[model samples]
Target: MRRADEKDDDHVTELVSRAEQALDELIKDIEALVRLESPSSDLDALRRSADLVTEIGTRYLGVGPERIEIDGRPHLAWRLGDGPRRVIVLAHHDTVWPVGSWGDDPWSLVDGVIRGPGCFDMITGILQAMLGIRLLVEDGVDVDGLTLLVTADEEIGSPTSRALIESEAQGCTAAFVLEASGPGGALKTERKGTSNYFVNVVGRAAHAGLEPEKGVNAGVELAHQVLAINTLGDPDLGTTVTPTVLSAGTTTNTVPAKARISVDVRVRTIDEQQRVDEDFGRLHAVLPGAVLEVEGGPNRPPLQASASQDLFARAQELAAAAGLDALESIAVGGASDGNFTAGVGIPTLDGLGAVGGGAHADDEHVIVDRIPGRTALLAILIKDQLSA
Candidate 1:
């Protein structure tokens, strides 16, 4: 294999060394960040996570409060290596786990696993990107335009942070999302298009025990709609539709007057996005008495990496040079902030954080052993991008 040129060789070696030395501090910072439990709906917790990130940014990242913003939301931005070809790291500090959903204390490193609410969804990602950048700078990789855009609402579709990600991404040439990598080791190059849909069934309520014929039975109608949604799923193409959230009925005796369902959808291609939309529309026809509403249509768009996305290829080379295994970039079923950046026509990579399983579950955790190596890969990726 050909070695990196003189500049590339020295920078890669130096960044790997610095990242190795910084791993302990990175893990500690990640543990503290996970303590905040920044669920997407909890503005306070998300903001607090952002604050914790910014504080760590100040102490270790060498950026001041002026570079940080925390009014209704928390954010941090920095410039590394001057020029037009800029690079940005965009990630959210939020998770799907709700408050009180986990154990009494959700933060701990048990047997090399950092177990917590937001540890897997992305607080760990923030730590990786933040600390990675710090190591990059400390290793003599002078970054004049290395910007980090850490936002609050990625787990719940990034309603508030989407605009910021797009705008920040526009200012850079490429972006990296701090989402967790594959189970062991890999980079995510593509993610399914997403849509969050809702269907409401409206009917007349009557006592099930007394006047059963007088009721329209919204709950029964909802079942029909749910079946229609299930038909949209095609396992062969990675497209899925699940009416995962349902709400209806007030009492056992009375027929449900109103029912609501929220669906989680994933599609492989842009064309399939339209198919999902058409299938969602069929929900209205399923129950004449029901009303349906659709929301959140493909917020991230597919990552869809081609050879044109040279950034991903460059990242692989850099990772290998840092003494890590060659990264196999693959498509993922989950979404990330990288989706937003890529939607805006920028080459983006996701899953650059800790390696672990159980995201959005009570058992969510980060594999402790993978932190340093992943951090090393990130540092090298940044250095390689700046100089590539």
Candidate 2:
């Protein structure tokens, strides 16, 4: 009798072989998507990609997608199947790069790698997902109970779409985020939570040249606050408190009463997040007349291992059966929509996109050869859940 691992590999091989047949068409679809620049903040540009996705979904899945507008930007949701147990396939269509930033031709294929704005970071994932689902649909795989959410503002912290994502994820069996895979194609099972804070200092203004002692220096108070914020970081615990953006003083000669600092906080757990929040709240301005005001907390909760391990185990088993290398999960400091689902106690698996690197960088690209296998893996994973 054959061993279980070998049997699993054979199953994966069959699925991958089927998906590999669609490689050329998948590349074409991905290229088409990358050419359409959909920066997160541009409503018009975002709609262009949104329309393209609608066209593709209608053509391949034989169904139309619902366009939901949040904060004036549109998001896409396509529900497949009618089963009671549903799976949430999470994706984002918007990218960080703005138009005209990638020179004339951002979309290009060279030496087995595809380079383009948002190609590796996500556009490729979206296309791959469509192709994967197409394979399942064509093979008559039962897929009557899945939800695909392609949001428009993920690059800007999902300010408007979080509620929609949470609502859709509610009652779903699991969530699979189409974020790019880790180095060597490892899946992400744990992710840090993101919390943003704005620290504003208010003080009385006076002429710098006259009565300097009477003017309360908000900039100095801000500096003190920055120092205190810096102390909140605990590297061993994977928690970081960074004051990313700073602004102070209206003019050069003025005493400069108002100052604002934007802080980015990443934590590995809710307790750690609470600890940092408490510390930030307890911070007091050093200047006697200066007052400190803090705003924002825990935008995306952490995807802890406790909430995601089961899904990760299942994915690893599926990967092994597919004849791929032994699958392992890693924790990343960056947060994704997966965090939101995992935060709600759902088993979530992430980083199931193309295998490559250079996300959000000038050299952003995805490995051309790896697309077929990854697509097959995702399709099988989705079918596995839907079948159950």
Predicted model with the maximum lDDT: 2
Measured against the true structure, the TM-scores of the candidates, in listed sequence, are: 0.87, 0.96
lDDT of 1 by residue, 1-388 (tens): 6564656666656655666677778777777876667776676886677677778877877765333434455655655445664788877666788777776777878888888887877777777787777776666677777777777667667676678778777856668777888767677877877878877778888999989888888888888877777888888878888889899899989989888888888877777878788766655645555555555455657666651258777877666555566777767788777877877888787788778878777778888777767777777777656766
Lowest lDDT 10-mer window, candidate 2? 319-328
lDDT per residue as tens, model 2, 224-277: 988889999999999999999998898777787999999999999999999998
RMSD of each: 3.2, 1.9
Q: For candidate 1, what is the lDDT?
A: 0.73
Give candidate 1 regions above 4 Å deviation.
1-11, 65-73, 79-85, 99-104, 286-296, 307-309
* Candidate 1 Cα deviation (angstroms), residue 217: 2.0
In model 2, how many backbone clashes occur?
A: 6
